[model samples]
Target: MDSSPHKLYHVHGFDSRQFLEHYFSDKSDMAFGDDVLKFPIEKLRQVFAVGHINGDILIDLSIGSLIHHLYSASEFFKNIIVLKANNRCIMELKRWVDERTGAFYWGHTSTLLQEKEENSDQCQDQEAKVRSAIQHVVKYDLEKENMTDPLVLPPADCVISVWLLEVISKDQDDYIRYLRKISRLLKPGGHLMMIGALDITYYLVGKDKFQGFTYDENFVRKVLAGEGFIIDYCNVKERTAVSDLTDYKATIFIAAHKEK
Candidate 1:
């Protein structure tokens, strides 16, 4: 594949390598560490060891950690869907999913797309427009309480999301609504795994500005419990990552499954 600026996961107005290394190093360390071995990873290994996920439909929202989790899974899922509301991440997700078998990509088009354009170059321009659009205009129609339409996802056997609920809305009620939307996408008895970034603040995505939400274990458990998920496992771990020339720290992992 060509390694051009357009083809790259461009980090705007920031050092790309620093951001990647910091975040990914935190992930790599905790994932390989004994802490996760004791909690979520081990619990999930037990549940999935029985072969519940093989040949099942699995969904991942936010695509970032999902990409990492897919790499670490001992058994492969037959299908996975990665969802992103951001156009740029969606584009990158499409590229990533295409490289892996049995994966699909979905981007919420409620905010971008004034009517779809055909040209691929135009599509990139559309992503750029969406990136700029969210920076200044924070509110949109697809927000929490207003989310009335059923999410249109390809049928899947399991659903997984990470760091998605809290960032979507700051209001607790809205966060619950976000979880409910994700839960509705799953089948009964299906598995759900979430890796949460608890109690953090504003962060940058590429060159774009995004508002961040802080979550604690109590807060996250409340949201998940309200959404009908049981805490199969959770680990409170810290991550030190360089973002925008500063070291960012926060509690950074969660895993759960839907209740039977």
Candidate 2:
């Protein structure tokens, strides 16, 4: 495990601009376009549209560098708390949240989401809604017994963890442990949404290589059920040959509710 303070899973000098350009933007150099980016976003939209997802509090257990998943979620949940594993990720996200100079532009993502959800292409209004709905952006440690220690937050009504477990977990055992730890933050019968890379070992960000835990859809279902969650939705998108950016074979998206 890389326990170094500065080299957390998603915080090794990660370039937010480079990340956005590589994955979300329509740059010619990007290997894939809307096909890859739209998969998780659209699946998440479907999960939230089911009408049971609304609540007073939603906790984002994401790595903090990506904000694409928050567009639809912000409208349904009254309060959103973003949790980060490292300072660098926290700072990058804060820049966008505060609309500081040099913040990575997310208007493209906002516009896409708006068009899909409302059938309108307006941008700034949706972005403003996300910024206003975010109540807290705080640090979290998956290794800790209480993921958000020292801050006694109430159990959340919904928790969304996107592309987090596979990247941070060192192995299958670690993945299950981390899942249980975070799931504890949810109230019984509360919902959990997770996105992960399937059958991959590593990913590239800028010039740095990040490790990932290799697993498939069956592993995801088994682990969530073991942690007292009832799986409701599970979908996987096979990777297109257009991108050599990572070793992942597929992207998995899941939504489940904790069993009381």
The weakest ten consecutive residues by lDDT in model 2 span: 2-11
lDDT of 1 by residue, 1-260 (tens): 22222211212223333334333334434232232222234434445555546544566664232243442232446445555554545444444334455332212221122222233344343333322222110111245443323444555566656556645655577677667877776787666777655665555444534445555778878777877777766666665433452122444455566776
The TM-scores, one per candidate, come to 0.59, 0.90
Best by lDDT: 2
- How far does residue 61 in candidate 1 sit from its true spot (Å)? 0.7
> What lDDT tens digits, residue by residue, belong to model 2 across residues 1-260?
33232233743546656656776665567664454567767888888877888889999987547788887788799899999877777788899899999887777676666667665654458778888989999887665677678887789999999888887778889899889888988998999998887987766666666777889999889888888999999888888746656678888888999999
lDDT of each: 0.47, 0.78
lDDT of 2: 0.78
Candidate 1: 10-residue stretch with minimal lDDT:
132-141
Residue 23 of model 1, lDDT score: 39
